[model samples]
Target: MTLLRPQIDPQIFSALTPRDDFRAIARWVEPRSSVLDLGCGDGSLLALLGNELEVRGFGIEIDEKGVLACVQKGVNVIQQDLERGLRLFEDQSFDYAILSQTLQTIHRTTAILSETVRVARECIISFPNFGYWRHRLAVMQGYMPVSESLPYQWHNTPNVRVLTIHDFDAHAHAAGIQIIDRVILHKGRVIDWGQNWRGSLAVYRVKRYR
Candidate 1:
């Protein structure tokens, strides 16, 4: 039996059961390009992008373990706090900058997203939908939603600012960022247009407008 290393794309080791944590990310990114992953946890997605997509990627993570994981994968990674902002990087330094699932954890999406557009020509953002029917139902039932996508209890949840799919679109407009494309995923399936609000989660591609 081979021991699984965190450096490798989790897929390289069969013993590890792969989950959808990185699914929306891979689907939104191009196969061959430069990418920067903000809030890169454990460097799993960067490894997948490099190995499977053949993309040169950089990962910025605050975790020591995650930084080490990227290094072991032969990926360029930086240890930095996103909330402090990206002053070191120049404008449009990368083809794409990804902020997956991390949107809710940051203090300010407005400023963070501005940095994303400034640092990269394009950006990919995916987040949990706070306005999901189930979430609403939980309020009615007097209990927070505990579904698979959002599995944690209210008190222990890591999410700070859960924005709905519609809320994101509005922010994009306010930021003057153009949506390159957007898609919603529900139960591991892609939903067509006009139904994203009703869907569970969503990923979007955005570009800074002139």
Candidate 2:
């Protein structure tokens, strides 16, 4: 299998740029692992992982422009709607399956997540935190919050179901999965306390329980 080899100079790899959440996700991945990226917009994260960790990456994207961009980046990508599920892929086909900033937008959350877990040994997911203090404050003020992570008006947003870290934890438990690692991010910084209340984004590395 072709895998990306980590650069000899760690500094060079550190200097390689990525979105904050993407960087967090990349760090959780082991070097030279196979990855399946769902809703990989423009193949940015996949390309970054391939270059930084020597991960063999495959991406699934629905948008034509995004698919074109992935091709230009030399990233292997298949065009497919995530809501339809991952029936095309077989069981345990990859080391990690990732869904970043796209969970809320998918209507079939449970189904897609199940497929992700089935297709890979581990699954990594990242999404906006609806329980953030700002969102609460906005609700208190009788309006939806507008922030960097959630940059859309209520009616115009693509996100159908925004959830919190606590919500996700409960969902995972109900789905018979275990969260191996969790990270909460607020304005690009890692926050320890009151993650459900203060965190703007939540990330998790998970696996199905035996």
Q: What's the number of clashes in each of the models?
A: 0, 1
- lDDT per residue as tens, model 1, 41-100: 766677777777888788888878877766666667778888888887899998999987
Runs off by more than 4 Å, candidate 1: 1-21, 193-197
Give the per-residue lDDT of model 2 (tens digit) for 1-210: 122222233333444457779978988899999999999887788888887789989888888898876776667888888888888889899999999998998888888888888899999999999999989899999998888889999989988988988899989966667899999998789989988998999999999777
Off by over 4 Å in 2: 1-17
**For candidate 2, what is the TM-score?**
0.90
Q: Which candidate is the best by TM-score?
A: 2
**Total clashes in model 2, counting residue pairs 3 or more apart in sequence or in different chains:** 1
Lowest summed-lDDT stretch of 10 residues in model 2? 1-10
